[model samples]
Target: MFATTDNGLSGTGKPESVFISWLLWQPRGADLAVEALKEVQKLSRYDDSDPDITRLRSLFVSLAGADGPLH
Candidate 1:
């Protein structure tokens, strides 16, 4: 059996595990990042009344075109 929380996959006794999983699963492109961010923004609780939400939306859209640099 497993216990779950608001963030999902809870009760593992390893908080950082979720972050590691996310980092490993993340896509490797600016366009994908932009699209993901946009989806997140849409699902987030922040509405138009929130300044931060608007700023983040603008930033994601602005970066939607760049392919990002090779590391």
Candidate 2:
């Protein structure tokens, strides 16, 4: 949902690759969130001190909407 736009995309090389990847994953966002959460849960067993984890959680919550996923 983020890495590209209808107007046009910028950057090159790595950024280009990442943008394409984001576009590909946009349709699987919810599944991505669930998998990310599952990964965090697994990592929590060892260490969950990464701030990136928090950011990932927040991004999913925002995407899920203020009320979150239905049911």
Every candidate's lDDT: 0.46, 0.43
Supply the TM-score for candidate 2.
Answer: 0.32
Clashing pairs in 1: none
**What TM-score does candidate 1 get on C-alpha atoms?**
0.35
TM-score for each of the candidates: 0.35, 0.32
Per-residue lDDT tens digits for candidate 1, residues 1-71, read: 96665433223334345334544676775355556455445635555554444444444444445354211
CA lDDT for candidate 1:
0.46
Which segments of model 1 are wrong by more than 4 Å?
1-25, 33-37, 40-46, 65-71
lDDT over C-alpha atoms for residue 32 of model 1: 59
Instruction: Show model 2 residue runs off by greater than 4 Å.
Output: 1-23, 28-48, 67-71
Best by TM-score: 1
* For every candidate, C-alpha RMSD to the true structure in Å: 9.5, 10.3
lDDT of 2 by residue, 1-71 (tens): 55734323222224334334644766643575555445445434543354443444444444334354322
